[model samples]
Target: MKLVKVLCALVLVLMLGQQTVFAAAPAPTPAKANEHSSTMKVTFYSDSLHKEMQLNVYLPPNYDAQEKYPVLYVLHSYKLNEDHWFDTLKMKEQADALIASKKITPMIIVAPRIENSFGVNSSKELGYEEGSGNPGDPGVLNKGMYEDYITKDVITYIDTHFKTIQSRNSRYIGGTSMGGFAALHIGLSNPLLFSKVGGHAPALFVGDMWAPLKNLVYPTDEIRKHNDPLLLAASQKLNKQSIYLDCGDQDDFIAATKQLDKVLKMKKTKSYEFHVIEGGHHDDAYWSSQMENYLMFYGATDHH
Candidate 1:
């Protein structure tokens, strides 16, 4: 009987030891797929333009509405709709990767469709001149007032509907090509609205003739001075906000962008950064490659 009791005790000891070992093992980290980021197609009425505007919003992985996140407004290139940023660039995937790795602070991305309005309140007609008119081409038609729609209407909608840090410091704006131009123009025009503005391969206007298509936008020298990014930078109209400008070496806008850089340098603006990346061009591959750089710049900080 004593021998039998000893064997049973040994079994209990072994069982307890195994239980301790199992309890000490750490749990595996959650997979990124389990917390995959999500995209929502949202449409809201814009009182500014007197119409409903479509927007694509990206919520970071494992997003919780109770938690507030900073917002980055990324404008699409002219003629391209809001989906171009996410569809062509795979921006949500990139954003998820950065956020999951903690390379960038988790934030929301908002891409609003502007109907090729150049992101401006061009003339009284308010909207882009579609049909027959190419981007940067003259003889265009006006449809709606987009600048107010984006800055005033869309922003208001996001702030009211989502848990967003609705402050200039938490707000960032960026785009490629004409969207870049719009970013520079709108971002600079409202200094108190955006903390950082990035222009990726911006289609900056050096003169009216540089882009015959832009005549449809600027239409006149006075309007050009007021709306053109180059002119705004030259005249030192840019507010005291962080400015980021980069263009491809092979991009046709390089010369004009360089001129803008020179003017910014001459103005002694120390809060701006300009780069001429090698083998870069005004194309999808080029923009896609720069997404990391753009996110790092925009998401570099978590505070104002």
Candidate 2:
């Protein structure tokens, strides 16, 4: 059944090819269409990580510092940093157009640099010493306390610095692939902090299949117990969270995403949406194409 879906998606992609939207960074400085969003590149200190981190914020056009707005925190895919959303995906330009045309409400987009930490903090077992290596391996300084870095430092920074709504319902979190998996874990774990959680092409661990991530992110069954989305959904109540889960039919993670959707439905969360995008794959092309849908969900739709 999944193979059939992939084949169908391939056919659709061939039939109606949408130009891939990811481009080189700095995005060629989009031509001013009308009133456009103001962009800010910020670098701030993360007490949790004990280092300075960077993020991209896109403020809505005609942004009034006094006017509070909702904030959407987007996580990029694996290997790629926050620049994937701002530069590669040209999210600022897209958001400007969407808000200018009133297709979606004006809001703030915050894309942070989360490297390969899998959106979680490092284990104390790993040396906190600064070293050069990939995560989960010896002699790697992947930064300790990533979960705290994001959940505490990042959130506190955004709220304190920006004109945000400053409420759980006004804050949103979503991501692609590894970032998606992290968003799911974090959002479910801290339901009072976010009312909406979206996972796009999330790299989920099914059952008994442990690969690369296990060595670093989920080293033990006990660690997986807390971070796994399936376990979290089964154990935690998502009653106050509006969840969005999507993947391309051709993507390998579709099956896992579907399973998560099933679990969320069984739990009878506040809301749930599972989308298998046609002609979509687990690549930037698919994610870039779905930006409109993503924006609509985050900006225009009513979570209540």
For model 2, the run of ten residues with the poorest summed lDDT: 124-133
Best by lDDT: 1
Stretches > 4 Å off in candidate 2: 1-35, 124-143, 207-212, 301-304
Off by over 4 Å in 1: 1-34, 126-142, 208-212, 236-239, 268-270, 301-304
TM-score of 2: 0.81
lDDT of 1 at 214: 58
lDDT of 2 at 6: 100
Q: In model 1, which range of ten residues has the least summed lDDT? A: 134-143
Error of 2 at 269 (Å): 1.7
lDDT of each: 0.81, 0.80
lDDT of 1 by residue, 1-304 (tens): 9999999999999999999999999999966552677899998988877777799999887776337888999998866878989999989888888877788988889999876567777655544444546545543434566778878999999999988998998899999887898898888777788988999998776644534355456767787776788777777545467889999999989999998788777654427899999999899999999898899888864542
